[model samples]
Target: MSAVASETKTRQLPYVVAITEGVREVLKEQANAFVAGEDVAGAGSVYGYYRGLLDEFGADRIYDTPISEKGIIGLGVGAAAAGLRPVLDIMFMDFIGECMDEIANQMAKMRFMFGGSATLPITVLTMAGAGANLAAQHSQSLEAWLAHLPGLKVVMPATPYDAKGLIIAAARDDNPVFVVLNKMSLAMMGDVPEGPYEVPIGKANVVRTGKNYTIVTLGRMLGQALDAAKQLAELGIDAEVIDARSVQPFDTEAVIKSVEKTHRAMVVHEAVRFGGFGAEIAAQIQEHAFDYLDAPVARVGAPFSPVPFSPALEKVYVPNAERIVVVAREQLGI
Candidate 1:
């Protein structure tokens, strides 16, 4: 990402297009790679993310399957073991519960169980986040649940650029990775490279920098935290914002360095506060950067409950700039 190339950028595409383009690029390069899921073929995908993949790859490479989560995971796990890269499409990550055994045991452990002889280059593409009023089942950010499991690489991309780059990276890895795309940021337009690229996994991006405080978050929550950081500047408070893009292989070193500089840290997410993924991050920050803290680490998230169907209730349930501001103020005793 050079200045001349970044400034010379010609195309800005919607978030979904980046994904479609990445998959298209990979399918063109890798003969053994194919996409499989219900309604993914044709233009029947829930988010229209795979709208044109079928036309490019043909019916053989882009094929549909029964509406079964177990079948989808099984297909990907078996295909990967047999030396093919299968991007299994799980419409909503919330549906992971439908095939937990297949995911938790088969796909996540096949390589390890086979003494490193088997490679499950399986990338599970799914949508998450609490907006669109799709209710609890259709809309939820379940990264924590997947990240808790060993032998799985969980990736959540916040921007269109990362969406494309990380997709390419995840597809190339031998580990089973969960590519969790947030629906809330689907329509966001941003500068994207024309060809495929890789954003290294297990790294965090410092989206904004300041000396007074640090805000670590990802997905839709990163936008809200940035908004809060901007407002915090009005009152003469400088805040650094970090996007922990890949949660499982989290960039703890980056976060610790930020905390060491700012002396205060806040973790935010759209998921519920209790036992949420932020807790894991907060604990890590405390462990590695405890002496640098001027105040206890603060976490801002929705209340512990199912995602509300009502848009009004849902708005309050998810973390917002106002809540973030209040929580940051409380953390600093301002």
Candidate 2:
């Protein structure tokens, strides 16, 4: 077998391994591709996703920045605008608030504001959601805030397959992309193709099909939803699971179609219930599939409170398989 075929035949790796592979592929493919963020270079990212990148790419390409979110993003935006592809690492998704102006106003709007004269090919890779007992600040899922922005592309890949492919696609795109990785998913092991792959932005993947109800989810919440679907099946309620991989350019058509078929919908996420991505999904479902609905749209998410530091409280605060099953049954009138 050829070298390519040999690599392709290798067994599947974990989500964090796929991420590392994706970054290595991008740096190998693009001369201008570089990485910058806190503890990214020498320390190899907070989660060690960039472990060997510094050694392979050298200090210039794999740079270490100060503990300043604004500075890190601003530098990435500047580099992207100047014709280089820069991938930035914000230690946690919650810190996005510190660089909201840089992201929302600057990087997101630069291309459109410049009348298409400039392309900001920047990717902001950050970890989100509450499962690690990291407390409120480090565990919040704020993809809703980024998705609300018009000019930015928001991507949340649930599986190792999509994670590797989507990260490469985001890096290669000429527009700004926010690639949010769930901290809990980093060590997840799954099958991933070895060659460079690209999962298109704004596309939704139907993970499982059923005719009874539709469960729309993203990020780590997807696993919970799938598990819940199995339990719902035993209870005589068939549930379809749709992974809303990209939120900004959301796949409303898929969601509408799924809801129309099932006539019952439940949106799930790791974010808070109020102002979460579930709200958007619920609103969209009501708007498009209202006539076909057999029951009201239900939402499964974290409570409207800060993530607790204790593992016991943290487990209760975050939605899990049990919560998903309960919400699905409630929506299905089971």
Candidate 3:
């Protein structure tokens, strides 16, 4: 027998970079996979995540539609119903309200109404949260609203690796998938493997392990929660960090397990405290892990007010690492 050699490759990049690479790969792999939205083709999306896609895929594949959110969503729904995997961008997640009827009534319910005969593989990518001081409308985290709906998948990627993998998975899934990418995570750098990869929707990732308390977070909050865990460590609190990557599917098993070990939990998010996604996580933890819990589940989120435009006020509006640390201490009775 002769010895054989195996090759290995490695690369590090940001979430936006990984997303760009995934979009390119999807465009290359599937002829049916098309991109559409305002400024998506020529402008490469508002955040420049889709930069050069128009040039590479051509105008036919990467299209720039008119500034009509409802029209863009309707087109995506129709195209998906007719057998095209269309990736539509609505720029900001808050703007999804503009096309609620199209997304909720048509795209989400079509398959079930048709007796499961149709497969609407539509992926809508949008930005959310309040960190860049983009004002009220642009900074809302409305994932909780979408997660409440049926026949739809909601994903929030916390890292560059998850961003690429989840997008690919969303493209391949039969249901309509809404990917809420955080603006802050766009430029965040991390390790990402090459080639096509898919992170199955409805799964949660435990980013950090500990035993004192569990902090369940999603999207941009995951970073802050991890940082908070680091600070808590110095204070003799080993906080576990769970990234609820998929809001709709929501990994209750992982969450319950974490709560079982820690016996304490603190749910955090950038969304408002009232009726936000954190509420649902808290409720679920209470339902399943109530017996294991030593204290009531705590939630840390923004106030019930619009995101401010002033940079100074915006800093106070969004949840940060220090806030998480403070909340964790209270929940742990430290």
Candidate 4:
């Protein structure tokens, strides 16, 4: 089901504010839910999304932990296993390396290893993407790492609406859910409904409907894909755009269906091209709709290198609509 609401009572909220509101509503609804992470309680997080949450939820519910990703994630795993819903914040997604053991082995496999007896209802909120010039260590899109895990659900919400809805949905889930948010989109604004709402995980949204060609996008790349669609339309190519909101339980059906109609498809993402999630999407499209494909499935992503610190290089390093349009044209022979 599409997560977007068509109600006329919606109001514009920045991507960061929507996230804060989502967490607020989750804490309000789930009595057992609590949020803990570095600088989240005292400084309201590095991105300022958690601003004012500590005062609203109190210290017990909103905790300030030491600068340790392993300890923070470990706390969530233990807390969730003990019946409390914990929202753990990993300040930068690149730091997932420091706590790989906790995530890959413990938090992700506790349920199955225990024969389904233990439940790790852990919701990890981490910042991703590379437009803020946070350098290599601080900026990265590592959703593929979590998505590859067996017992984890990975979600990348592009807009303010999905950011809010997905957060609430992740909090209420019974398994580990990673909400990979884009740091560059924090100031982006969109319509969001008041109160709590859930955007179902593992669902894809057809943001733009077209014929001729299909453009499947992940996370922040949705906007670029849409822009490329418009530019392609001007050049007599109607491109259908599908947002792969969830990466692990990817919405293969939506993409395959679009490819069947369009006969050509391309996957786009902010992560590096090699060994990126877009490769997985491209493979799925070919495997499911190979007979109907007019051309090989194409992929557009950042180069396989660390996110540059130089603003000039970083601007070129990130994938944009022009790149997508060029790739689509080359693949489509238009």
TM-score of each predicted structure versus truth? 0.97, 0.96, 0.96, 0.97
Number of the candidate with higher lDDT, 2 or 4: 4
Model 1 pairs in collision: none
Best-performing candidate as measured by TM-score: 4
The positional error of residue 213 in candidate 3, measured at the CA in angstroms, is: 0.8
Which candidate, 3 or 4, would have the higher TM-score against the true structure? 4
Q: Residues 229-293, candidate 4, lDDT per residue (tens digit)?
A: 99999999999999999997899999999999999999999998999998888888878898999
Between 1 and 3, whose lDDT is larger?
A: 3
lDDT of 3 by residue, 1-334 (tens): 0111234233789999988977887888889999999899888988898999888888899989998999999999999888899999999998988999998888888999999998999999989978887899999999988998899999998888888888888898888999999988888998777777788899898889998789999788999999999999999989899999999989999999999999989999999989998888999999998899899988999999999999999998999999988877776767
Residues 194-292 of candidate 1 have per-residue lDDT tens digits of 876777778998999899799999677888999999999987789999999999899999999999999999999888788888999999999999999
Return the lDDT, model 1, position 106. Answer: 88
Cα lDDT of candidate 2 equals 0.89
Off by over 4 Å in 3: 1-8
C-alpha local distance difference test of each model: 0.88, 0.89, 0.89, 0.92
* Clash count for each candidate, listed in order shown: 0, 0, 0, 0
Off by over 4 Å in 4: 1-8
lDDT of residue 174 for candidate 2: 83
Worst 10 residues of 1 by lDDT: 1-10
Clashes of 3: 0
Residue 175 CA displacement from its true place in model 4, Å:
0.6
Off by more than 4 A, model 2: 1-7
